[model samples]
Target: MIRLAIAISVVIAVPAWADIAEPSGFRGEPYTAPVPSTLQGAKVIDAEMALTLWAEDAGFVDVYPRTLKPQGLPEGTIWQEPRHDTIPGAIWLWNTGYESLTAEEMQRLEDGLASMTRGNPDMPLVIFCRADCWMSWNAAKRAVDLGYRKVMWFPGGIDEWQDALGPDLVRAEPVAP
Candidate 1:
C-alpha cells in the first residue's frame, strides 16, 4: 500500500518537475535563449555568408522588438523611447517575432515583408535579431511560412555583423504597415 501511495505521489509531482514542451508552432517567452542550429525552410548562415548577402543587396529584416513607454509611471515621469540600431538597409519589423500575434501585428509583418521583397516572393530575404535569440528564429520561420522563395537566417544577427564588418549600423524605425 505504501509503495502504491509513493508511486501516486511521484506521478503527481512529476508534472511539476517536467520541462515545458517545445511548441510545434511558435516559440514563447525567454526569447533570448539558445535556438536550434537549423530553421527547416531557411538557409542558416554565419557572419561571413551574411556579409556576402548584404553586399549583394539581399533584403534584410530586423525582428528585434521595440521598447514601448512603460505605463502607470508616477505622474510626470519622463519616459524616453529607446532607439534601435540595425543593419544599414534592414527593415525593422518590430514585435512581429513574438509567439502570439494580434491581427494588427500579423498585418504589420506581412506588410513589412511585402515592402522588403517589393512584391517579389523570390527576392532574397535575410531575417535576424540578436545572437542566441529565438525571435530571429521565429521570424525566419515565419518568412518561410509566408512563402518567401529565398530566406536566409543570420542567427548571429547584428552583433556578429558588427564584429565581422567593423561596426557599421544605422538607427532604424519600424516600417509603417
Candidate 2:
C-alpha cells in the first residue's frame, strides 16, 4: 500500500516540474496576417513585399535570422535554397537553425546586421525565415531592438512566396565559398 502511495506522489511531483512555460509568452507573440503597412513602426516587410521585390526589383533590403531553418538540411549548414524560387536580390542572414537560439547565435545575428546595415541608419531592411514560424518573429523583434528604423518581417518567409509566385520565381543554389 505504501509503495503505491509513493508512486502516486512521484507522478504528481513530476508533472509540477514539467509544467514550466516557455519564456516568450504563449509561444511567442500573436501573429496577424501579413499586410502592406505591417512594418510601419519597425520597417518589417511581409510576404507581399518580398514577392513584389522579387518581381520588380524594388529597393528593399532583405535579411534573415540565424534561428530560421530550412525544412530539410544537414546539421551545421547555415543556409539552403528554397525548394521554390525566391525574390531577386534577397540576402540570407544565417543566425541559427529553427527550434531554439543561444546567446552566441544572437550575437552573430547582431554582427551580421551591423555588417548588412553598414552604418546606414536610415536603411530599410526586411527579415524572414519561414511561414508560421516563430524564428522570424524573434528575429524581427531583435532587429527592432537593434535600432533598425525600417525593419520588415516576412511572416510567410519562403513558403508563402513560393505558393504565390508559382514557377515565375527563380530558385538559387546554395553556395559555400
Candidate 3:
C-alpha cells in the first residue's frame, strides 16, 4: 500500500512544467486517431474488445495521469472528489518526459509489462487511460516497439469503458511509479 500511495502522490503533484492533470512531461504525440491505423503489428481496440481480451488474461495498462487535488482553491473551499480509475486489473503506467524513456526506465517498463503478461511476448496487452490522451498512445506504441507482438490500445479510455460498461462497472488501481 505504501507503494501505491507514493504512486498516487507522484501522479497528482505537478512538476515545474505544465498545469492541471494534463501530463506536463511529454506532449509530443498527436491526440487524433488515438489509435494508430498503421501500427504494423499492434491492434487498436474498443472498450468491448478490451473486455473480451481480458477474459483470456490479456495485460491491461492504464496510462492516465491521476489528479489528486485542484490547484489554487479558495481559502475555505472544500476539495471536490477526484476521479481517476482504470479498467479491472489495469496497471498504472507513468508518463515521463515526452515519452522519451531512459534506458533504465525503459527496461523497467518492459519488465513490468512482461511480468504482467507473465513473460509471454505473444500475449495480448490492452492499454487505455483517457480519451484522446497521448500518454496512452505513446505507451501503446512503445509497447509494440518493444516487440510485445500483441499490443492493443483502447483509445476511448476510462470514459469509454464507463460509457460502455456502466459507470460502476469500471475499476480503479493506484497509479504506479
TM-scores for all candidates: the values are: 0.83, 0.52, 0.65
- List runs of model 2 lying over 4 Å from the truth: 1-40, 43-45, 54-88, 96-100, 166-177
**Model 3 pairs whose backbones collide:** 26-98
Tens-digit lDDT track for model 1 on 2-86?
A: 9999999988774433444435789988998767777788898999988888889999999999888788999999998888999
- After TM-score superposition, what is the CA distance of residue 72 in candidate 1 from its true location, in Å? 2.5
Give me candidate 3's TM-score against the actual structure.
Answer: 0.65
Candidate maximizing lDDT: 1
Give the per-residue lDDT digits (tens) of candidate 3, residues 1-177. Answer: 999999999999766444324332344755432333334456878878877887777888876655665788879988765655567777766542136776755665676687788888888888776776666767777787678888888877778877887335444654444
Best model number under TM-score: 1
Greater-lDDT candidate between 1 and 2: 1
Model 2 has an lDDT value of 0.53
> Would you list the C-alpha lDDT of every candidate in the order shown?
0.86, 0.53, 0.67
Per-residue lDDT of 79-171 in model 2, one digit per residue for the tens?
843453345555554543234456766566666666666866456666766665555656666677678776767767777777775345444
lDDT of 1 at 48: 93
